[model samples]
Target: MTDHLGSCLCGTVKFEVHGQFDSFYLCHCEWCQKDTGSAYAANLFSQSAKLAWIAGVDAVTSFTLPGTRHSKSFCKLCGSALPSIQVAGLLVVPAGCLDIEITMLPTAHIFTSSKAAWGQGLRDVPEFGGLPH
Candidate 1:
């Protein structure tokens, strides 16, 4: 595993994570789409214990989307999305901020049923009908 660091667009928020990442992958869930204002979100998961916030917790914001217990963290200064840890304590970091290169391909794709039709053509990756739990 490798140790890495990253920050938001304005550098107001920064974090560090320890893990050997092969590469980050795209998440096509509708929540990802709406949260990122993009077609998909690039993210990678690591243990919560491996992540550390270096600065700007004061600018962090949290939101829960309607009925789902799943909540999200973001940068209030720039609206840049941040990673959230689940009850299992898995830290999911946005892949774009990684300072080190990932070596492993994404293990699988979750929420494939909600993927945009225009986002198709990823025929080789394993896909799940719903969230990959």
Candidate 2:
């Protein structure tokens, strides 16, 4: 079983996830884009992984969209994305929250039909290690 540690942007909330991830998906659904405020959401899925809050558990808050299965957990202070459990024992972990290197790459890009128009051709953009001069 692989173990991973993660935290919010401000480090106010810390957690550990234990077990191997079976799938990783980059979701481009509208809800996912809005939840992440990005082009897509990188999420790791595990059916039997265990999540344990190591610190600032009270600083975390969760929200579920009424009348829908969409939900998100975040640090109340920094508004950073955290992990959440979905139905059928699925553990969803946002890849960005992980502090350690992840050996696995996204298995697929789902919800392509709902992808933002601007989300395409991102590879054409310039790449830089840091702030460009």
lDDT of 1 by residue, 15-97 (tens): 87776544456777898888787778878876533777889978878899878965778889898877667557777778776
What lDDT does model 1 reach?
Answer: 0.75
Give the C-alpha miss distance for residue 34 in model 1, angstroms.
0.6
Question: For model 2, what is the alpha-carbon lDDT of residue 117?
Answer: 93
TM-score of each: 0.76, 0.96
Count of clashes, each model: 6, 0
Candidate 2, 23-125: lDDT as tens digits: 9999999999999899899999999999999999999999999999999999999999999998887899999999999999889999999989998989999
* Candidate 2 residue pairs that clash: none
Off by over 4 Å in 2: none
